[model samples]
Each structure stands twice: as C-alpha cells, then as structure tokens.
Target: MTPAHHQARTDGPPHAPELRAAARRLGRRRFLTVTGAAAALAFSVNLPAAGTASAAELDAARLTDDPFTLGVASGDPQPGSVLLWTRLAPVPYQADSGLPAKRIDVSWELALDERFRRVVRRGRATAHPEFHHTVHVEVDHLAPGHVYHYRFRAGRYVSPTGRTRTAPAPHSRASELTFGVVSCQRYDQGHYTAYRHLAQEDVDVVLHLGDYLYEYAVNSSAGSRAYPEGTLPDLFDRETVTLEDYRLRYALYKSDPDLRAAHAAHPFVVTWDDHETENNYAGQTPENSVPPEEFLIRRAAAYRAYWENMPLRRPQLPDGADLRLYRRLHWGRLAQFDVLDTRQYRSNQAYGDGWQFPGPESEDPGRTMTGDAQERWLINGWHRSDALWNVVPQQVTFSQRFNSTSTPSKVSMDSWDGYPASRERMLAGAQAAGVENLMVLTGDVHVHYGFDIKRDFDDPGSRTLGTEIVTTSVTSGRDGSAKPANWETLMAANPHLRFYSGLRGYTTVSLGRELARADFKTVSHVTTEGAPLTTAASFVTEVGEQGLKPA
Candidate 1:
C-alpha cells in the first residue's frame, strides 16, 4: 500500500489507439526540438563508443567547480563485467547540469586497490548534453568474484573513489551471499538516515525495490530536513512532468551526502514502482484525470530520465516509454535473483486502485501483475534455475495483507493481494519448477513485514510455499513507531504474517546453503540527521524449508 495521496481513481480502461496517436505527436515534437545545430553537436559525439581523450583535449582546467558533485556509482554486476556511472553536474539543478551545449570527454579507471597504484582498466566516454552530461561505462574482462575500486575524471577534477565487485563464477560453489534491501525514500518526508547506516554495512550489493524518489514537489525548506530558506530551486516546487524536470529531480536527490555515500559504498540494482512517473499508474493508463495520449508523453520523458540517471547498461536504455528492466542475476551456485518490473505491465487496479474487497474483476485470471510475457519469462527462468535459492527482488508485497479482521477484509489494490490470479500463477509456476528454497524480497508499504507465502491464504494450516521479506522505507513516513496502530488487529487477522514493524529503515539478508537469514534494521528517528541504527527483528528460513522461524 502507498500513501494516502495516491487516492484511488475509478477510470475506465485506456484506449490503445489514442495512446499510439499521442506517442506520434510527442515524437514529432521531440524531433523538431532536436533539429537545431546545438542539438546536432550534442548527438554527434554521444555515440556509445569508447576512446581516449588526449591531455590537450581534457577540459578539467576549464571546469571551475567539481563536475563530479553527484558522486560515482556502479550496478548490474556480472561475473566478468560491471557498469560504472557518474554525471558531470557542477550545477545539477540546471537543465544542462551546468555544461555547455556540447559533448565532454570523461575518463574512468578501475583499479585493484583504492590508491590507484595498480590500475587495471581505464577508458574515456563522451558525455553529451542531450543525456544530462552523464557517463555510463561498461567495463568488462575482469576476474570473477573480485572487488574493484573505480572513479571518474573529467579534465583536472576526479570523483570520489567507489567500491564495486563482480559476481562469482557461474558454476563456482559459493558458500554465502549477503545484500541490503531498501525502497521508498521520499525526499520531503524525512532525512536519509537509513542510507547513512547502510553505507557502513558490509554487503555485496543493494537492491532498491522502488520509489527511489517521489514525484511530489519540494518546498524551499526542503521538507523534513528543514534546510535554510532558498536552498532548493523554485523549479522543484512543481511535480515532475518534462524530461528536464525529471533530470533535475534526480540531481537534487542525488545531491544528498548520505545517498551519495551509499552509492559510493556499494552497487545498487534498482527498479521503479509508480512514483517514477505517476502514482498508481497501470500499464499505459494514467491515474485518472489526464488523457491516455498526454500521459504517454509524460511517461516517455520519465522513462528516458530514469535510464539517463541510473547505472544501467546500454541494453536497459528506454525505447520511448518501454524499458526492459526485468532480468536475472546469478551469484555462483548459492542464489539466483529474478528482478521484476511490476508497474510497467500491470492491469488497472480493480475498483479504482486503493484498498478494496475481493471481487470477480480483481480475481480475473486474465488480469496480470507482470503482464503475460514477463510472467512467462519468470516462470521459464525458474524452471532453468540451478541455484540453491530462487530469490525474487520485486516492488510490492507478494503475500496477502489484510487490513482488518472482518468478514470482507480490505487489501491493497496496488499490491499482489489485488491480483490473486497472478500470485497464484507465480506460486504454481515455482512449484512446478521444483523451487525448494523460495524467497521474495519486497518494499512499498513503508513497513517491515515477514510473511509465510502460503499455498492457500484462506487455510491457516496450508503448505507454505516461500517467505516474503518486506523492508520499511528509507525515509517515507517522517518518524514511524515500533508498532503501528493496527499492529495487533493485523497480527491476529493474518496468521501467516510472522512479523510486522512500523519503522524507517531497511532489511539485510544473508543467503547460505543451509538457511537464509534476514535482519530488519531500523533507525531511531528520521526527522533529524545522525539517527541511531538498531535491529528491530531477525528471522531465518532453512534450506528446503518454506516458513520463517526466529533466528
């Protein structure tokens, strides 16, 4: 479930013809804007090509301010390759990211040590103004299961050193794997204290489930952070709509020190839920008020900005409003992660899209949560998985969450509970594929939840199929309590729900051959900086077992 602001809208289904027509209009508009001479210069050098910038060609001396202010990041690691990212944002809030209307040469180095004395790979990539002067370098031909240090240099200025690691060899018998999970960090709700603590954890990688940044406006005071007046630009006070707006929003969010520290410390595998575009959006359908064609234009802008800002590879780049984000990652023989994109190909929420009672429309087998193609992809991936643990890093809760202990309990329409047929298909697929150790990692409700994914929700003694670990927000709800007001009722109503906590923090999981352990880490407060971190709870599920137990 999301915040109250994402109210349910009872809009009819979206018309495909109108959406296609609107996309053509938007494409023509973009073509006209990019036909100028400056646009030509920006695109000419923006090809995804690798080359070295000569010493004389480096513009470091001309950059008075550090162009690496947004910091460096890595993501989508493979056994022999990894993606490194950095934006030349001397003035991040500006439309051009404080760069001229041309391309700039950015050099990066991958070293065996942090001191750069033993450099392994070094290359140059051209950052074009068309892409907000951001660089995405895919460095390959590295050792498997090895740690590496990376940094970017544009002319004379160098970025902060970032730590990254490659996955273990595909057939290697890796003993254990540990990773952090986080989501829903609304910049205006609270401080990013959880991220500060996460930066210090000894995790291999971080899976950001969604809502990396909200689409809402930020005031001059910078929300709960209480910054001094005029700290944020006036442009951020409006909801993100255009490509420039989305890019600037990313700049402002990435400008935070704690968020930057987390990125520099570990690689992040990210996916979006809804706030990346609009709240409760279903497929190409808008929330309610906007027309389908108009919404498609906004969706295209948002998708392009998302690709430009994240540390994703070339294949993940958006073609209009579509991005192939659902993929699989392997960590030796220990775990296989199936990262999912639920927001992009979901059916419109039944009965408007908020909390609602179960009905025929919501239970239709044709209605999909991951669309037909992705659903088949997931099931097929599971059938071919040889790893011990089949872990799913997805956006929403996969278990049924009952809001009240009544005859007709209400469940979130935006979560899996609203699409029971989809959930059933996923569980059946896993069972058919003989997935013994199933684990689902989720984040979206802004509360920590541990549930036993039962084969049948209505039967308390039904067979447990897997375990779902729902991490709380990084800083969504300003300052949450140890137990929310509905704790007791929800606990009593849902017997499969093993644990629940209303705290602002994340969850760290350690996957091993014998068992998988999860630690719910929470911060004392998020309205102020330097909040003390604590472990709210711990649970574990053993290999070949499907339910969670106290660890």
Candidate 2:
C-alpha cells in the first residue's frame, strides 16, 4: 500500500496545460473571434467533411444542439471563486459520446441575477477530447458571499442555468452555515428520491461522503431484488472496471433528472468510497485477489473519470491515477472541512472482510487507515485550523460498531474499528489540540448512525472526544425496513450509539457559533419514485459539549 512500492501510470496522453492556459487567458474581444474559429477548426478535423459522409454519421449540429446532457455542477467553493463543471455528452451513456475526437470551445458566463441581466464574468475553456469533452472552469475574482447564476454555451447549445455562491470572507464572523449530507447512491437499488428533496432545501453546500456510484452488476430478481426489473440497461449489468466503462456509468447516474436537478441547484463537496473503484477496496488491494499492477491501472481509470465528472479545481486534477482528492475547503471562519480519502490510503481489512472480533492484528499500531503521509496531513490540518467548527467529511464509520454485547465483541472490519490504533491517534490528537467542536460526517454503511466518539469505547463513562454523524444512503439498500431483525441487539451492544435508522435518505446540518444541529431526514420509499421525506430524528451539539443531545 506504500507509495515506494507502486509505480505510477505513464501510459495516458500527455497533459494539455498549454491549451487550457491559453483558453483561460483569452480576452473578451479575442474570445469572440479566436474561440469561434477554433471551434470551426475542431469541427473540421473531428467531424465528417460536408457532403462526404454517410447518412448514419453523427450530425455535427447535434454537438451544438443540446450538448449539455449530463447537467452542470459546482464544487470546492472558495471565498472568491468556485469550480463549474459540465461534460459535452449530447449522447451520454454510450462509447465516444457520439461525437468527434477533437477539442471544442465551451463558453461560460457568471451573472449576479438569475435572469443573467447583470453579467459579471464571461470566459471560454477547451473541452479536450482526452477529457471526454468535459469543461471545468475555475471562475475566480468573484465577490465573496454572493450568489451567482452560471451556464455553458457551445455552438447553439445553452446549458441549464445553475446557482452557485462563494464562501464568506475569511475574517467574517459568519454566524450560520447550512449543508446537506448524502452518500451511497446505488442506481439499481432505488431511485434518487433523496436528491430531489435535497435540491429543494435551503443549503449552502451538499457533502457527499462516498459511494457515489456502485460498482456492482445490476440484479433485478426475486431472491435478491436488486434493481426493479429492467430498470438499468443491459450494457451496465456488469461491473465497471475500465475508463470508458466508468464514464458510461457516470452518464447513467447523471441521466436521472432528479440527480441532474440536484447537481444544477447547489454546490457539492464529494469524495469516493469502495464502490467507486471496487467493492471494499483498500489502498492498492482489491476486494478479491487481483495483482497489484492490474489493480493500480483500474484505480487510475476510476480516479480519472471521477475528476472529470466532479467540479474539482485544477490542483485536484489526476496525475495518471494518483489524484489528490483529500483536500480542505473552508467556509470563511465559521467552519473548515478536512475531506479525507480513507480508501486510497488504508491497510487491508483486518482478519479478512465482514464482521470479526478484534484480534491482535486489528489492534496493530502499524496498521493505518489513512496511511503515514495522509494521517500526518490530517493531524497537522486539525492542529492548524482556527475555525469554530472543524468538520471531517470522510468515508467509513469513525466510531466502534460492535456486533455482540459479550466480552469478545465483534466489529466491522471495513470500518475504523479494524484500525483501532489509527482511530485512537486521531481522537487523541484532536483532544490534545484543544479542538472544542470536532464533528465527523461519515458514510458507506448504508444506514444512519449517531455515535459519541470516546477515548475508551470499552468504558461507558469514558470521556467523549467528539460526535460522529453517519448519513444514510441515497438508495443503496432499496426501501429499507424501519426495524431490521438485529436492531435491538445492535442498540444494546453499543451504548455510545445515540441514534440509528434503517430508512434511506440524508442528513441536513445547520452550523452556528453556539451549537450545531443535525436533522436526520429519511425517505419512506426509494424503490419507487416520489417518496416523501421526513425528519426521523434530530440532535444538537453545543459549543462546549463533546457529544450530541436530542434536539
């Protein structure tokens, strides 16, 4: 799992830094002339020559006509800028996107009004064929704490208008910030009913902890009851492994009108878990026995597609397959999010996978979940952060989840319980740094869990270090039951667990200087469309309180 043993992928096309830079540097006057001509030249080279093509050939007009099929998304918001993203996939969910292999000019504009009458900034960027014709414009020099409307334009195609807002100024004493938390959106399991409601909420940002997409084959049968029968196409019935495969999978998920609407409505802070690459993959190791070399190649493809689709800034751009996804985003002085990449830098699951009693191997101090470098990075970030609330948005459960109440307690190997020493270090470091309001937002269990993180889980009266809020999946478990068979046993097994829910939905949090409140929103049904959302439970953590209290 260490970097020294793994060789980076050097087989992809060279980086087009010059084209990207030139596109960004074009003035308004030059943009009209140079970009138009560049678009024509790209068409000539990529598209079939006029009067010299078959009737079945892709229509060049289609590229310009409704090119923004996947929808627009904004992410990684800062004080002065936000990243805008869109892919020119007129014919999404197919190989090559039914377009030519040439770079196209994509124009974008930011306006102060929803009507776009008060335009503030306008620019053009190249949608490189190598990047699957995806455009990521890092719009900067914007007014802080201002809401802006944005859209993309190609030939005759105009994208849907998207709303985005910059963070408050760094020194501003922002009183409150609201955001929604979601994860584990398995397409076949259920519809994106949660996102439909999330889009309607009044929130600043949406934190997607992980499991954005599942890497499993669709199974719509009686015994298992995967996706509703014939919900997904036959092409996506198999698992995604290649770059093209991953790209198509994204198209499939993005094609959902509800999901697309959510992305277009608000900004998102996204990270991936095991399902994005492979089921329960840990570092360079795949869930099953696959060679390290082959697994790395697969990882590279998955990471590349992830960056292309997400609204990430240039620094997070993929270097082959080694993407720097673990970065921080600050909401002025109110809150600072230290996004973690737990899957990419973790030791293999201890004692194989599934629930297991914690043995000596699981307690090994050398066995790390965040690896050496990332663990240091996270701890250092925590120490240096001055924000009132320090939020760690990451994958996997941060607190212990025992399977039994007996002396020989069994825990999920996939969670932090397997890496006990690493988890302890993080908790102890936060305590040492005097972090008063350390909040952990988690995903990947497909169930909602609220836990009081303690220095000693074995002792019920141990000092509480922080609180962990684990949001439920968007649709991972289909329409889950209110009380699973082992619900009571689990509730009794872990005294630290404050709340638990089996329904599918998300969590909405409102952060203030005095306290933070989390609403555990649940959808009664996700198997069919139009599920009603309700607040299953609510909790609040006061400024000086180490754990959550019923709100």
Candidate 3:
C-alpha cells in the first residue's frame, strides 16, 4: 500500500493574503475573547437552561438499546481535575446518533475503588443534541497521582467503567511516568488490533499524536477487516466534508470494540495532523481544488466534531474555523509534556508539499512549522520548566530524514526537514533554555524511528542535543515488513538514525529520574484480526547525556 503522506498531490494555490492576516490577527487578546465567547454562546444555546421550569428530557426507561456504544473516556488529567466523556449514541452512525432533538441528563460518578464502594465525586451533565448528545464532565477536587474508576449513566442505561489517573502535584517528585504513543489509525486500511493490545498495557496515559481517523471513504464491506455486508451504513462511503459527515465518520471509527476498549482503559491526550481536516493543509490553505472560503467551512465542521467526540475540556472547543490545541501537561516533577499542533499554524509546504531537494524557498527563515505564537510558547515553556524531563509530544518528525544517499538528499516536505530554519530555531531555543533531558515523541510516518538529535546533521560527530522517538502507525499501511524499501538507504544516509522498523503498533516510554527507556512494540499484521504484538526494539537515553543507546 502507498504511504498515506504520499497521497497529498498539490493542485491548489497557497492561502490568500487576507486569510494569513486573519490568522495573525487571531493572536490578539480582544479578537480571541470576542470570537471565543461568541462561539461558546452559540453552542450554549442548545443546552437546557439551568433551573428551567419545564424542559424536555430523554426518558432512559424508554430506551431499548445501549446508549453508551461508543464507551466512556477521560482525558486532560490534572492534579485536581479530569475531563470525563461519553456520547449517548444507541445507534451510532446515524445523523442524530439515534436520539431525539432534546437535552438528556447524564449522571457520572468517580470512585476510589472499581466496585464503587468508595464513591468520591458524582454529578450530572446535560447532553445536548446540538453537540451530538455528547457529555463532557469536568470533575475537580481529586487527589494527585491517584487512580480512579468512573462511569456514566443515562436513565436506566449504564456505561462501561473506565480507568483514569490524575497528574501528580505541581512540585511533587514523581519517581516514574509511563505513557503509550500511537497514531495514524485508518479504519478502512486494517483492523484495530493494536488498540486491543494497548488496552492491556500498564500505561498511565495514551498520547495520540494525530490522524486519529482518516477522512477517506470506507466501503460498505468496511475495507480490510471485510465486515459482513451492510454492517456499515452508506453514510460512510464518502469523504468527510460537512459537520454531519465528520460526526458520522467518528461514530463509525469509535464504534469498533477494540478502539472503545482502549479509550475505556486509559486517558488519552490528543492532537490532530492534516488528515483530521485534509491532507497536508497549511494554515488555512487547502490541498486540492476547493476554494479557501469553502474549505474553511469544512474545517470548522471537522474541528467541531473533533472537540465533541474527544474527551477534551470546554476550553479546547473550536471557534468557527479555529481551535487552540497546543497545550502543556505536567506529570509531577518527572516530566512536562508540551503537546503541539503542527498542521494548524504552519506555512505552506515548500516545493508543493512533496518529497524534493532543498532550496532557498524551503530554507526560508520566515517559513515556520509552528506559527510564531506557538514557537514562543514552546520555548518559554522549556525555559520555565522545572521537571527532570522536558518532553515534546508532537505530530511530525523533528530530526532530518534523508531518503537517499545522493548528494542532494530528498526529504519529506511535510516534516521538520522541510523547514530547516524552524528546526534551527527550536534547537537553539532548547539550548538557550538549558534543557537537560529533551525528548521528542512523534507519530506520523507508518514506520518506527529512533534518532539522536544532533546539533548539526551534516556532522556526525556533532553534539547530541536530544533524542527523538517516532512511533509506528496503529494500522495505516496495512501489514508492514521488518524493513521497508527505504530502510537501508535512510540508515546509510543519516548516521544519527539508530533504529528503524516497519510494522503496525505503538511505542511505550518509561521516564525516570536518571534514564528514559523507549520500547518499540509491533504487530505482525493488521489487515486481518487477532495479530499478536511483540517488542521490536528497545533503546534508552540518560538524563544528562543525550542520544539513544540500545538497551
């Protein structure tokens, strides 16, 4: 199968000057406050009024099927709070999610024990049809670095119990932190066997770097999994372009039992790549023939659906066509995770966004991967971080990836290799901030990669500034091989690259005070079900010393 990144064949012009100006203007505090409040108000209108005399409510006793088919999830954990999520979709994939056009009361509970003998927090949230009947409850006043069991209930229906954990106290010294990194799970391409295995791992949280659900059409037979005829609805037989289209697409993907199992197993911290909206889009610029104005509409729909479906707080909600997703999460004093959004605030790809030789245009200093505001934010975060490890969880490769051994090496325009100036600024910022243990976690390419982030890729003996671990896709490229076609060439051209593997799986990283160990896990196949998972490779980097060493 062709790599998903190769699918972006540029056939449209760059973003208009006015749109760029608008994006820049969005940085102003006044504009953001106005637009954000307006958007929130528009969304709030659908919610039932507090202390209303007579408001419509869904009768849980009248339901026949399970409303929690998509399962329960929790995310964005804090020392005192965690966001709980569940959508009441008895019959998922429907336009209204098999619910009437009204508000439904969903009660949720958090307990110290799995059996609910020690109930801690309980409250009710209104699931509005305007928001696809999804409930996002932000539970606060919880203990730090503690495990909790949570579930939701609507009428007589009860959701599956989900496990969640809060971050350690701000200044506490955490001994260790372990998380699973995963991305690029295309429902049509293969089965979600990776998620099934991930649910069993002893991970505290799961970081979804991007491409949670592809926008491609899924056949009625459901592509590689080959479900029985009529299993999937006809609504999913086309690309997602509208609000309803995106909503149904998510319903279809989340309906999978394995995917739901993973959500119920651990909390997820998510960020989107280009596929969440379109392939290789830059800022407001699209990849194909769609007009910029029309494309923004589609983008708005995609962003809204993404926020509604994920276990995110209200602050991350979208405002028209824009959503602020880049934020920081702290795991006590052990590590600080700066999750980034690369696709939203990036310059158009150099050389039409394809694999090409470097040039002045590609090396332009003005072109940015993370827009100016985000760049400053990241650098500032690093400067103020007091954790033992400063971890950057992002969507694309941070190190240079040479495709061939030729003099003029061809690199992916979609990655950091395309914007050398941007990469330079990032490295320089980290150095200036005196970051000791900088670890970048990436997921986009269908293959796993371990790179020693060098101060200068042109010089093999240059100082190893940091380490980057790229996880393989969940199931994007179908069943992959141990060595892809470019594996040897990449290894030969870039000595900084230490490990490479082509397989379907995720990566687990255990961060301690002195050492951070990364285990590259893989599965033999994904086109068919029941693929056994195994460890493909393991590498570790010391706290003060950078660079990967085989473990």
Candidate 4:
C-alpha cells in the first residue's frame, strides 16, 4: 500500500504495462492489485516495490489524490445540462475514523472536442463526506443536440476524458438519435469487451437497466470477484444489509476501469433490478435474504448506495432508506425513455425460485411486479408522452413468455405473465392513449427476445399495441443454455413472443423521424476476454408501424 514499494508486475498479461501506467499517471499509487481470473483487467492493480515512486513525483501526486481512479462518467443529461460523477477517493479505503478532515477541491471542464482545446464551460467544487465525497455537478448552459468532452482536475492530477451530450430542445424537429443500452454486468463472469465496444459506438446515452451489483457471495453464483474462478473475498464480509456494505460494494464495482471509461464517455440512464437489493425481493421481504428482520435494513442500505453512486436528479436522491427510481428521459423529439422500477415497489415472489409452474404466489390477484402505484405512473407516462418513440425502459420482459404450454405450463410466472391484469393495464393504457411507436426496452432475463406487445398473448391475432425488445445479460448468465425451443410446443399456446436469443450482450435502439430500429449487440464469447461483438439481430419499426419487424 506504500508508494515506495510500488512496482508493476513484469510477468503480468498484455495490459499490465498499460494498466500500471494508467494508474500511475492517474495518481492511483497506494493499491494496484489485479483481480479476477480474467487476467486481462490487470487484476486489482498489483502493488510493486516501494522504490517505484520518486520524491518529486510523490510530492506532486500527493497534491492531487484520486484523480480518476473510478474514471469519469456522465449521465441523465437534459437539453440544458448533464450529470458528471466521480468519487474523490484520495484514500479509497480511508475510514471515517482515520480520514483526513480537509475537503478536496475538484475542478471539471467541458469542451467541444476531445483535445479540450476549445473549452465550453468550466467550474470547481469541494468534495467531502457529506455526500460520500462523490462529485455530482449538474453542469448547465449546454447547447442541445451536441456532443461534448469533459474531464476533472484536482491539483496536478488530471482526470480521464469522458464524453456527454445534451438532448435537442423539445420538438426541435430532430432527425435522428442513437443510444446504446446495457444492464446486469457481473465483473468476474466476463471481460468488458462490451464497454470497450460501446466506448467506440456513437451513442448519446447508455440505458442501463440495473443489476450493477450482485448480493450473492463470491463464487456462490456464476463467477468470482477480485479473484479468478469462483474466488470471492468477503466483498463486504457478507451480504450487504448495512449502508457501509452497500458503499463498499459500489466502491468495488466502480473500481473497474472499463466500466468507469464507459461511464466517462457516455451519459447513462440507469434503473436497479433485484440484485441491487437481493435476488428477487418482494415488498419488504428479500428472496433468499436471511434473518428476515434485516430486510428493510438491507433495502435501505442498497437504496442509499444506489443514489450515492448514480448521477440522478436531486428529487431522486435517497431519503432515509427509500430512493426514487422511476423517471422519464427525453432525447429530443425522437425518443422518450420512461424508466421503471420493477422491484422496489412490488408484490411477493409470486413463484418459486427458477421458473416453476404457476409461480408460487402469482395466482394471487393482489400480486404485482411493479406495485399498483408504480404501474399507475407507468400508465400515466404512456398516455402522456408525445415523443416519436415511447420506449418503456423496464427491468424485465414486458411481453408474456411461456417456456412451454402444449403439455403443461412452463413459462416464468415471475414475469408479466404472473400479472395478467397489470399487463392488460399497460396494453389498455397504450391503446387508450393512442401512443405511437411504443417500444419496450428490457433486461434481467439472461435471454434476448423481441416481441409484438399484443393485448393478449393467448391470441396472436390480437391487436399488436406495441413492441418489446429485451436484451440479454451484460455478463451474468452463461451461454448455450438451450435454444428457447422451450416454447416450441407452446408457440400455439402463447403467441406473444416473436423472437428470443440465449446469448450475452447488450442492445442498441436507433430512431429517426420515420422509423426506429433495435439492434442486438452480442459478443462472440463471454467466458474469455476481448471478444468481438456482432449484430445478432436487427428489428425495425416504421413511424406508422406499431409492431416489430425483422430488419
């Protein structure tokens, strides 16, 4: 942990030098431990010999600590402003007990280009423990329909470069918009080739549908963290039920440079899924969370961490143990993203773990995926939005998906199928509101799917009110699980599904005044690092079109 003993691992993999140099240049001198079996991430940044730092460099580095260890990131930008976030972790592990009392002054800048030669706006502020010391300055006075490069500086340390953009003014006659969508990325399960790929995509915002962290203990699930092959250190020593545990988990996840870089480059619109709290939490009870008495305490911790880590509006800030998650984001006049909270306010599990027949409590007319109140809000948004595309950014599939129905029902009861009335409410809302270009962008289920959101799944000829495009997991689920032929015999029974993919990757939805397109960005491999991404499938919807069509 000392600067004097810091030495880069010479025997490390290809990114060793780049990782060390990047860390050293960014003033991350204390810890450099490489983590994960992925070897490609330069691990947790292994520390070297104490002789690695020079007196002069050490003195300068001290002036500006935590330059951009977590990297630069932008999110939820409106036409006039955007959110810039970065934790000022001069001493990342420094505790409230032994922490320095002085507040660090961090300055940020926005430029028209990456080089920063033509500066647009600049400002400075103090980062302290009041808000966990994470700097979230809602930079205003930005021009609409334009891209800008941003960075932060504290003393001699310069932050990593990030890119952000503002939406065009309302009804500005915008011609087109392209945004990258991703969610549920478990660090150790795979390399972030998707983030790397996304950094290169010309996207304005990244629609992240949560599961940013898993509550499961290391290796207990699919992959390990901070180590390779199922090796998971007590990330928080146990399941995160207290605020500190959530804080620690966020710190661990934000440590990934790839994730950081993507955030720095593009503004993100994010919503938490079940893992943010527990596997699949009911109202106050967490699915698989122990001590049941600790449910509310765990929810409080998770919500607090979610707000503290995300770049959200002031109203969305955490209050006590509750944090607001549902909101709306409009990208010019092309698309309006209605982000939903599927887990926060919801009915109980409704079913047993792992898609069982007639999910446990699903039959209860009282059960709900998104509590009644939240569902009402969604209905209101659908009926009110006027954007060309009303993209419902929810945590799970909106269309009913039955695994099989010919012999016996095998579809997941936890999905919308469990809440038929709710799905009907959504369909009726869209229909009654005369909403156009209604599209659902979903995540959570480790499979990719495209569907025509009809009024009823039992009747395919039923009116197709909208379209639902579900992206697979970022790095969570393993591939080759079984071709969704699980529905082959039941295709005639439940006709809502139009397409499904059992791969791992993200989705990109592009929109113009006349048409909207959904592209599945799938990687060649997930177990290995640096896999190439390909367009596995593309679906398009014309301006007057309401259903999904193969592209």
lDDT of 1 by residue, 1-551 (tens): 01122222233323446445644766855533432222223222323323422122335568888899999999988999989999998888888777776667888999989999999999988776556787889999999999999999887899999999999999799999999999999998899999999999999999999998788899989889898999888999999987788999999899989999999999999888899888889887889777555576678778878988898887777655667899899999898999999998999999988999989989999999999999999999999999999999999989988999998899999899999999999999999999989999999899999999999999989889889999999999888999999999999999999999998999999998899999999998899888899999999999887799999
TM-score of each: 0.91, 0.88, 0.92, 0.82
lDDT of 3 by residue, 1-551 (tens): 01111122213222335444554667645544543343333333333333541236776777788899999899988998988999999989789888887677788999999899999999988786767888888888889989999999888889999999999999799999899999999998899999999999999999999999999999889889898999887889999988789999899889999999999999999999988888889887789876455576677778989999999887786766788999999998889999999988999999998899999999999999999999999999999999999999899999999889999889999999999999999999999999979999899898999999998989999999899999999999999998998888999999999999999999999999889999999999999999898999999999899899999
- Whose TM-score is greatest here? 3
3 versus 4: better lDDT goes to: 3
State, as a TM-score between 0 and 1, how close model 2 is to the true structure.
Answer: 0.88
Alpha carbon lDDT of each predicted model: 0.86, 0.82, 0.87, 0.70
Clash count for each candidate, listed in order shown:
2, 0, 0, 27
The TM-score, computed over Cα atoms with residue i paired to residue i, of candidate 4 is 0.82
Off by over 4 Å in 3: 1-55
Cα RMSD for predicted model 1: 7.4
> What order do you get sorting by TM-score, best first?
3, 1, 2, 4
Quantify how close model 4 is to the true structure by its C-alpha RMSD in Å: 12.8
Residue 290's lDDT in candidate 1: 74
Q: Which ten contiguous residues of candidate 1 have the minimum total lDDT?
A: 1-10
Worst 10 residues of 2 by lDDT: 1-10
Order the candidates by lDDT, highest first — what do you get?
A: 3, 1, 2, 4
List, residue by residue over 321-352, the lDDT tens digit for candidate 2.
Answer: 46778998888888989999999889999999
lDDT of 3: 0.87
Mark the regions of model 2 whose C-alpha exceeds 4 Å error after superposition.
1-64, 219-233
Model 3, poorest ten-residue lDDT window?
Answer: 1-10
